[model samples]
Target chain A: MDTNDYIVQVQDLYYRYDKENVLENINLSIKKGSFLAIVGPNGSGKSTLLKLMLGLIKPQQGLIRLFGQDINKFKEQHKIGFVSQKANSFNTGFPATVFEVVASGLTKKLGLFNFLRKTDHVKIKQAIESVGMGKFLDRNIGELSGGQQQRVFIARALVSEPELLILDEPTVGVDVQNVNSFYGMLETLNKEKGITLLLVTHDIGTISEKVTNVACLNKNMHFHGSAEEFEQLKINDVSEIYGHDVHVLTHDHHHHGGGHLHD
Target chain B: MISGLLQYEFLQNAFLTGMIIGVIAPLLGVFIVVRRLSLIADALSHVTLAGIAASLLLEKKFMIFSGLNPLYMGMAFSVGGSLFIEKLRTVYKHYQELAIPIILSGGIGLGVIFISLADGFNTDLFSYLFGSVSAVSRADLWTILIISILVIALVVLLYKELFLLSFDEEYARATGIAAKTLHFIFIIMVALVIAASMRIVGILLVSSLMTLPVAASIRFAKGFKQTIFFSILFGEVSVLGGLFLSYYLDLAPGGTIVMIAVLILVLAIWLKKRAATRSI
Candidate 1:
């Protein structure tokens, strides 16, 4: 595939927070319209890689590109949406409705001097409705459930009509019961909307089946391939990067588990 | 009060200045309070106080400084203090809140020294400290009018950027919204508003005008824009109500304004609690 076909291209990327290298010789290429999940154990440098990809932090060495532009020269930031793990860290008392939160996504695109015009409001409402949050448009964002709040944040990201969406531990505060539906919504965003997705999560098992590609990252890229190939790998092979024995719970741990326990 | 306002030039200046500050202070206050930078306002006001003191001293001792409004000097100091706070926040990244108190005490210390060097408090100083409706000059009113127009325009233009930055700074930065530059401008706006508000609210009570209305609004407002709207509403009520009451009762405008704001905040909290209980 052409370099332009890849939404994100990272080659020989190395990052060091201090004396220790957080990511070493990382080469990642995410195809357009692909859903890629980067998973690893705690302190696995997954977040650092995402940060580098988003241009939040410069890579210590090597090249990182987004939409075929060098990360340093990538100026169309509004084309790449980002949703942080704000679901848990947000101020519950912050006075903002879901509609207002979603509308903030257009801030950068609208520039510093432009006010929200009529089209912008329509876009904001559509984004919120797309996330199944239309009913909660007027509800204070803090009043919603964690999963619902995450949905609002997702709508905020989507409002900009970004081609590439990046989320860091988006399900941290999301409820277990709603986790499936959340992933389902992401799947629709990826498959139907044709938006490329790069998600960072420590809970690999929860996302493994839904993602098109998986990159197992520790200090190095231990695995980067189609999700089927990743699932085919032995449990020991996966656990090796974690530096400890780790269980791969592919979401079914929540379903068909009672039957297994009874058997 | 209407008759007094119409009859006296000083009263007109004071009331007009109060009206302008009532809108801008609480409008910016919504962002400040939400961003948890309320202390920054207090700190900037103190620094403005220092500037006022210095200007008063210069006018007293130096021919060159005479006939100049001290508000201009206070404006300079307030802006300078804001820039310094930004610099200090970066210096002590882990202890960002430390910057506010450090600037606050430094400002008050400089103010006290300047006051002492200027032969301590006199009638003019008293008026500045407690707010005097009769002391606001036509020049001061014009300065405030210009500053209010500038602040209000900028706030309207940058409303979404400010909201995004305040709500989630990391996300704002990730969107590549020139976060540092926006933040720098915001702090300067805070400084300008503090300087503009000091004439009617008094130096010591100016931060209250910036914060208390927003505090009241937060209890009742359902959304971000609503918060700003309600804050400005509460601010206008407090300023106008306090101005009229102070005039009729011969009370200090600054103290009266701040007390009225406090009462509104209490009422808002009570009403919100009552509503919550009724729903329960």
Candidate 2:
């Protein structure tokens, strides 16, 4: 693929918290319209990599490019929709309707001193509808279930009409039953809406089937390729990256029969 | 009370200032309460007290300073204290809440020093502490008006940015919303509002004006805009009712206003519990 086709590019990225290195010699490039899942064990710098890409934090050393432009120089932030981990990051009791929460997504695009126009209301409604939250537009955000709240947050991110959607451990507090539908919605967004998706998750087993691309990261980029090739990676290679023995089960079985680190 | 409000300039000044603050206090309070920075208002008000006490001492010592309004000095200290709190929050990121107590005690410590230096509490200081209906001068009203206009304008201009920042700060920063700059402006506006509110609410109880109405509003408000509307409504009721009751009953306006707010909050809680039980 051409370099311009890539939505995210990270070269020789290094991040450190004090003296210990969180990520080292990391390199990655995500093509446009690709559903890529970055999976890793606990404390494996998966979220850190997402944060760097979203410009939430600065890397100690490396080059990060968004849409082929240096991240530091990229001003088109509305082009990238980001939903951080839902649990513990927000005050659930905050008084806001789904429409209000989603409308706030256009804040940066609206710029300083600018109020929402009539056209913006239609867009906000459309965004909420896309996330299957059209009925919950007037409902209190705090009153929704965890899965519904997550969907409202996704709608919030989508209201900006972003070309790329990035989520960091998006299903933390979501119920096990709802997790499937949540992933389904994301899959639909990625495939049908054609939005570039970069999800940071630890549910490697369940998410592997939906994602078109996979990047197994632990401190450094261990593997970056098609999901099929990733599934073919030897268990020993995965164990080395996890720093522990991890058994991979190839079927739709619920139990993997191993002590897996779910982070 | 109506006739007295129009007949006396002091009453007019107090009423006008109280009405303006009634609107803006709870307007900004919705954001403050949602952000969980209610204590920051208490801390900043104490800092304003220190400034007021220092100004009183200076006025007693120098004739030239006697002509100056203590509101300006109080506002300066409140703004400075706000900036210091922000700095401390950055310095101790993990223990960010520590900033509130550190500044609160610092404010009281400085205020006590200034008060003692001026030979303890006098009639002038008494009004600043608990608020006096006749204490608000025409000049003080003008100061309050100017600050109210600035605060309202800033809130309108930065409403969307402020909403995003209060909702999810990290997400706001990720979207290049200039979080730091907007936050600085926000805290400074909080300081100004606290300072301006002192003439009606007094230093000791100014934070109650900012928070109590918001606390009540959160119980029933279904959306952000509704919360704002209810907060402002509660605030107006408290201020107007308190002012009228204070005039009729010869009570301290600040105490009366805060007590009214407390009653409203209690009513809201009771109503919310009733609704929940009914639903069950």
Worst 10 residues of 1 chain A by lDDT: A254-263
Cα RMSDs of all predictions? 2.7, 1.9
User: Candidate 1 chain B — worst ten consecutive residues by lDDT sum?
Assistant: B121-130
Regions of model 1 farther than 4 Å from truth:
A87-89, A243-263
TM-score of each: 0.96, 0.97
Whole-model lDDT values for every prediction:
0.89, 0.91
* Model 2 agreement with the true structure over B12-39: per-residue lDDT tens digits: 9999999999999999999999999999
Best by DockQ: 2
Query: For candidate 1, what TM-score does chain B get against the true chain B?
Result: 0.98
